[model samples]
Target: MNRFILLFALCFHPFALIAQQPVPVKPRILISTDIGGTDPDDNQSMAHLLMYNDKFNIEGLVSSPSYGSGTKGEILRMIDLYEQDLPKLKAHRNGFLSPAYLRSVTKQGRRGNAPYRGYSKATEGSDWIIKCAKKKSDQPLWVLGWGGLEDIAQALHDAPEIQSKLRVYWIGGPNKKWGANSYAYIAENFPGLWFIEVNSSYYGFFSNNNILDSVKTTDYYDKYIQGAGYLGKDFKSYYNGEVKMGDTPSLLYMMDGNPENPARESWGGSFEHLSRSPHVVFNSATRITDTVAFCTVVEFNLKGPEIVIPQDSVCFWMETPYKNAVQKWPGYYLGKGRYGLKYVPKQAEIVSYRFRSSIPNVDFGEGKLTVTNHWPGKVNNTDYKLGANWYSDKADPALYEGKIQGGKTLSKWRQSVLTDWAARWGWLKK
Candidate 1:
């Protein structure tokens, strides 16, 4: 009886079962980017991905330019830099794929946006995606759409059988607008398709204001990336020599999370499920407001030794608010060492107030004021006309409502990305 009890416990014990299983590693990733485009941020993102090549099984790198001027040549240029730095990266960790192998897989997709229906015609990139998906593998191929989803839509349209084997994570705020037809086709036909549409949350990577002081400064880039290796050298050249890998979050999400479930929190920001196809619901809202009023108070505190101030000499100066071509009100003294200003802001105005006092012995301190009638969700059509700035008409409410696991903030997610970056550079251990 004792022997029977021991055998049963051994069979069902949770700890025993857990101990027998192998720890899962990162997922297989196929990056589809529009590098070499008008926005150079994609190049920075590619450099970031190559630095951490050991973390993922990178299957393909395809250039799918939707709007900007970019192609496979730019992808090769970035990879050439990666080839030069591969030796140094390999010294820190194993499993770095050969540069030649990466080059062999890099291909060009549709040069511009897809037709109104999404799939235009077969391209090397789309065909490659189909081939990769159909290959026998225990893991699913994660098609990361950093640029647009034209190639992905083409793959699905050509080989619908691979739908079950593929998982898509599209960076779809403005990119969605570029590939509207393809996105619409995929959504209309594949209701149950396994996909995650990341719109505003991806903005968290670059928009995180709470990163470490070191990361915010030039010292971090100089130490870890700039002049560290060939890859680092190429990375510093992009974004006016700043670390702005905006699209790196797509891979960061797959690096350490449950690949089967995107809803779980990971280094990549978490997402919520969509109730309907986002394409069908997206429409443009008209501009409802012409002017927005802003007010702020500035104080000058004379802390140190006092100095004489010439009467009527300009004591303070504030620049006109941005997009204030037709200023309704300009900066003026409110008396008692305080100042206030009001102005009409241009459409989709991201405005800030700046002021300086001429008081010789006083330190100009900051003050606060409340703003009213500031339209929060006003659509700026001018922004759309410039580039990919299409906002969904009926925006996905889940985007605002969803929360990452552990209630993680963008700052925390950025830290995770920085940590991995540091680890790859041999600054920190794996």
Candidate 2:
């Protein structure tokens, strides 16, 4: 009986020990972007991703439609640049034969991808997207898309297996008043990922204010438009004088995430007239006379700040102090003005919450939005270095040319030049 009792106790002891073991914790992340084609803003975003390698075990970067070439091309080009341009130290550099390295450089599993030989100088964004999503299940992957929604859609389509593992935080799409693009069917097809769009006309939506208008083109032209320049002198000269039309915002969105000092980051939302709500002429652009009503107000608990398009809003900002503030309120026809108040029945107070100690009001244009208090404020400090602007914050394009001769490799030089331009253009933080 004693021996039998001892055997039973031993058998259950291991089971109890197993139950007491703690589960492993996964990493958290927040991705900033200026995706699309190989533009300065996108380049800045890539630099932000690379600099903060440790804070975010960055699963992958989703290419948005802001730059130029759309999602696939943007991802491929950025990845290629990282592979070709980023300076590799003696311990870090991978030769021609290695497989791609996806995870943070500090991790033990970090190595060259042996199987994908075609990834020579390729970014492998597609591979990064699928693999990062598959790595963990519990921790939410935060993807901030301040540009077009191309890469996220492609990632979802490419890797159905990891769809449930990630969440998307974007900043575009039509406002509540206007119906969004029907053809750009990314979120609709991939329901597994959480889709959050931050509308600009909405009160809390972030804005990429026309900082370009604030500076003169001739002030910084010809600085880096010479030989080996990304966009040569012809492009610069064309853009320098009034004769040039200027690059599209889409192109700017793709290459870099910002174009000015890292500290000059922007946020969403328009609250210029909140102080005088009812009396103010809040515009309502709802057009419905019968069964189908597209101008109805939708409300959700905003974990962060959200721009409001109240139902009761009248088209009041026609002129005066609120002229710039209320120029284009969403949900209204161009020539037509507001007729009445659009309201949400159960709507309560307007609430805005910020992470305890963030960059305050770092804006990334219309499509980008930040969650409130999602992580402790300390996370920002720990990951702050990753967000530092690698290029000079001066608003001069010539800085790009001057830096190339400063001991930079081909990749570093390219990155630095792009980053410098991005910082000047208000796509990156200082």
Candidate 3:
């Protein structure tokens, strides 16, 4: 072969010495998921993780559905399927964890979002988090916040000592809406913890990219997953077999390359470091024309019916729109004509809200706020670097869909990730 051709072939060869990465020690992981929730994406992501279980030190699989009907039963259902398919999985890879062991670590987290105080009573899942975080290990516990951050917040509140041992990768976009209080609790109290809050970056996994059409989300499952195995066959019902594993990026980030480095390029997208999350305040009722940052706390202070209560006892609620559904945030006491109410918009959608008071005297208030991807209102923050290891997506967009987003960094590697995943389908039946 010609010199240039030989060099190209050697570099691209699947089994070439340079192409092989040194086997990395499995990193410990604890996944909090809303598997049977409104969106079936968690189910898809969980299936993906189980297929690649041999890659990580899977510690916890807690059912923590922030919204919808996700339960431990749903998670256990997935495990049952994994058990049925285990024989095939082991034939392909030796280190696959036993289904019984996976089930043993699974626990039920809080049913819904945390209360106004950021944490409710501790659940089995929250306690398990404390247990796993406290375990003696050289590796830091990688807590993948797939759904609500309630259990993690509860765990941190229950044991602040575990903060030093945890590394969080939260999927916060719309899920953030489900657990604003818990998210706020963690952000305000545990600011020093090493955290990666990937709000929109996870969209890259299923969103449109420059990858081959066949390998894209719509086609990959049919081509590689349909006849694969028990888990693969069951995957069809979730989102009709199309790939929408938004929460899988947390697994991808640790799947290859250095899991310790967030800025480094890997199958999962690289991230930007940020010192503080955006926190904005409103003095009066916000108008539909008003705008706020995505995932940032937007504190509201309004002068309503002046009937005062004992330390703002009257409960104030707000109903906001989210992806064809109306979601209400309960118990924000801005009704004493005070600034006690604060809300965090999940996505970049225009947030229209109607405030309803539980007390008869305190009345209703309605308004709207346009949300954007920018960190602070009216301008993008260039100084996103942080002293602590906090990571997020860049405001810049090298690849644009509707606006500037950091998803391109992750989407750029979609082809390789999907190709590898497609190849693994063979293991399911073999």
Residue-level lDDT for 181 in candidate 3: 73
Residue 138 error for model 3, in Å? 1.3
TM-score of each: 0.66, 0.32, 0.89
Measured with C-alpha atoms, the lDDT of residue 425 in candidate 3 is 84
lDDT of 2 by residue, 1-430 (tens): 5998667655643221121112133234434344443334444344334422433344444433322344444444445544433333112333321115432311111112111111112234445555666774667665555453334444555566665576544443222121121112342344334443332221111111213222223333333323322222223433232211111221222223321212221121111111100111112221122111111122111122232444322222111112244222212112222222112111122222111112222121221112221111112111112111122112222222232111111112222233344343231111
Q: What tens digits encode model 1's per-residue C-alpha lDDT throughout 1-430?
A: 5998768655643222221112176678898998988778898888878877877888899999987888999989888988877777777778888889999999889888764445779899999999899889988898888987889889999998898888888777557645555676676666556787665566556653443323542344666665566766666677656666668778777775576655555566665555543111101111223222211111122223333443222344434343535211222343454333222222223334444555563333332223232212333232111111111112334333232111232334565466447656553222
Predicted candidate 2, C-alpha RMSD: 22.2
How good is model 2 by TM-score? 0.32
* Model 2 score (lDDT): 0.29
Candidate 3 structure quality by residue, lDDT tens digits, 225-247: 97988889899998789888889
Q: What is the lDDT of candidate 3?
A: 0.78
Candidate 1: where is the Cα deviation over 4 Å?
1-23, 211-214, 217-219, 278-409, 426-430
The collision pairs in model 1 are 118-182, 283-393
Query: For candidate 3, what is the TM-score?
Result: 0.89
Which regions of candidate 2 fall more than 4 Å away from where they truly are?
1-40, 51-54, 62-68, 71-131, 150-164, 173-195, 201-430
How many residue pairs clash in model 2? 77
